[model samples]
Target: MTIAEAPPRLAAAADASLRWYPGGPYDLARTLGPLLRGNSDPSFSVQGGVIWNAFTTAEGPATVRFNPAGGAGLEPWVDVQAWGPGAGAAIESVPRLLGAQDDWHGFDEPAFHATLPRMVREARRRSLALRLPSSGRVVDQLLPIILEQKVTVIEARRAYRYLLHRYGSPAPQAGSLAPAGLVLAPTAAQWLQVPSWEWHRAGVGPQRSATVMRALRSAVALERLAGLPALEAATKMQAIPGIGIWTAAEVVQRTHGCPDSISVGDYHLAAYVGAALTGQRTDDAGMLRLLAPWQGHRQRVVRMIQSSGFRKPTFGPRMTIQDHRRH
Candidate 1:
């Protein structure tokens, strides 16, 4: 919000020094928040007012650090630095990674907010700092999400950290400037090489491991989906076995910034949506029916209301997480 209306474009000086602006109410953390699995996540980091992201580009591995710069009443601007062979590609991805490519027009309109629940309306007023970033890296988004299928968040985060740390190599060119011991996620070949025993050690059961292996076999096709429309990309993803509506939607949410993609099979999402809307719990059908009024911006609606901190009362006991490694 502190940024000027006509943000400056990065000069063609140095690829590694690329920088751009979101030109609106952009909050760096909010834009990239969903990509982080946990503090132990190898790919992302935030410290000392800077954010570092290590990822694989088609060219190779790279570490990107982005910072929002503002002081002395000056309008805030973004600063970016990169390291690796893929640094140029990583630099080019800055815009989409900060949601410069996103279109949240209708969702921001006051008229639209007038038709929503009071909590959601209030959330929208405060949520201008958020954006749904499209990372445009399909395999990068898909790997951890596949491991997350039908599992508790604790289970999923554990498995993701284990597998990533074990298979991923040290990120290239991340010196003292980058996060200490930062790691890049494994390449498709490295992922294919992971043994079943290692998967067991990571607490990924046979079914989930098989699904990941199957999806990796189509890595080329999946990577190509970034160029397609979000809905069509989701449909193509569903054609793969073990990738249902939930997984496909989740993938497109990151890779395509698909605003309408809802995690229909999620354990808590439907209840959360229901609670935010009417202060009463509801099933997936009811959530869908309630969200139907804003079919195109459903995910935007979810983000806003959930950001409002209004949710169904939690009186029930927590479900015990299954330890798949023991099986």
Candidate 2:
């Protein structure tokens, strides 16, 4: 069924509460697992069986809670609840957010399937319920990804935590989700007003902070990219200064659920894919050549390979954590 045909109860309720059952195989945890930065992500909290995510939509700040409604099964449904001014929009987004629009039926091809190792094939079979979540919001994903540029995960996450704590508003129903505070991301205006000192305190360097400001200045145009296809959306995003292929790939993976957008400049992805598939280290070009056959489903293939628990041999020094704040 189309999005327009979604349950009337969902759109009608401004308070935003609805029960949804995905007709096909679905795993809420596996599908949305990547969206969460880590268990410590201040914007998201998973407790017991429920996942709570707080974000600022065009309408306003909102908090969404996803609870499993049925017993453990391949096709279990979820009971969704939303709060705050953007509740209606958030509720309307449930279907896409839960991956209702991801079409993976034609994803697995003969050549790609034939190339997979037994372990990877088995992993793929077990994760058939996993789907790519589409947030349909650019700024929500873009800012954090920009913060991640040229920084360690720990540094990036620290900056995100600090910025949200300092500038974000409290999520309306965050108390129910966790005892700790859950906050929505800062709005465009708020992001623009953040002092350079604050950015430094948050461990964000001048370069990354400037990048965010540039995107915020064009926030309206950037948000419009959500309606575009993944490639086009990436292209539009790359037009901004400091936003490159890696940043664009990261953004579309969450915003559009683009399965083909690969992180071309990743430090370890090419090596990992190369080591797993060819038992050798490969650069981005080699990785692209290897993944050519699985063009449309390249990210899906990468995720499967990652889930297969294969790791590349570490032969060199790791990237050291840098503290720009001190500088």
Best by TM-score: 1
User: lDDT (0-100) at residue 67 of candidate 2?
Assistant: 78
| Candidate 1 global CA lDDT score | 0.82
Candidate 2, 1-327: lDDT as tens digits: 323222575434436777777776667877887788767788888887789898877788788888765556544678787878898888889889998888776666676577767656776887777878899988888998999998888899988988888898788764433446887888888889999899998889999999999999999999999999999999989999999999999899888888899999998889888887778889999999988877798887787677556778995788889998888
User: What overall lDDT goes with each candidate model?
Assistant: 0.82, 0.82
Taking all chains together, the TM-score of candidate 1 against the true structure is 0.93
Model 2: which residue pairs collide?
none
Query: Local error of candidate 2 at 217, Å?
Result: 0.6
- Positional deviation of residue 170's Cα in model 1 after best superposition, in angstroms: 0.4
Instruction: Compose the digit string of candidate 1's lDDT tens values, residues 67-169.
Output: 7876466555678877888988887787788888778788767787678767767888778878888999999899899998988888999998988888888
Worst 10 residues of 2 by lDDT: 2-11
What TM-score does candidate 2 reach? 0.91
